[model samples]
Target: MILLFQQPELPKDQPATETQQYGFELSDFLSENIWYLLIFVLVTALVIFDYYRRKKEKNNGN
Candidate 1:
């Protein structure tokens, strides 16, 4: 178990590389999921707004 938990040391001269670039890509992600697919469960306000808008339109329509 100790052997599994222990990590091998790396050279002190170089920094460790990151797998991903951090921070959100708001525009592309928001457009792809929300605007196109309308995955409403992710956002509470959007779900509520969509429900109200649909209800209002259904009631108001001839």
Candidate 2:
């Protein structure tokens, strides 16, 4: 079991290679999902809110 967990040693003669860095940014997230998708989601949320608000108001009035 210990042998299965052991990592093979890398040769020291090979030169190190540069790795590309990944970073998160607001613009990247917006572009990937599409900005209009986010806006429509917000509008849908507002509509749902107004629906519940009206329903509560009608119940209280009766």
Candidate 3:
């Protein structure tokens, strides 16, 4: 089991740098772009709602 998920060992003589330690942190990214994420979600929801509303109206008319 351990061998199934073994990772490459880093050199003990040199400590891992900050860039190597934490690359592309999603929590930090989301916090920084929370506004954009919210806007995207809102827009996507609105578009999906509008599509279903229009489809329901068409079905009712037919």
For each candidate, what is the lDDT? 0.70, 0.82, 0.91
Candidate 1 vs candidate 2: the lDDT winner is 2
RMSD of each: 7.3, 8.0, 10.3
* Model 2 lDDT per residue over 30-50, tens place: 789887888999999999999
RMSD of 3: 10.3
State which candidate has the highest TM-score: 3
lDDT score at residue 56, model 3, on the 0-100 scale: 100
Clashes of each: 0, 0, 0
In model 3, where do residues sit more than 4 Å from their true spots?
A: 1-14, 17-22
Model 2: residue 21 alpha-carbon error in angstroms = 28
Q: Is candidate 1 or candidate 3 better by lDDT?
A: 3
Cα lDDT tens digits for candidate 1, 1-62:
78997769965776534433444466657876775555456577788899999999999995
Count backbone clashes in candidate 2: 0
Q: Give me the overall lDDT of model 2.
A: 0.82
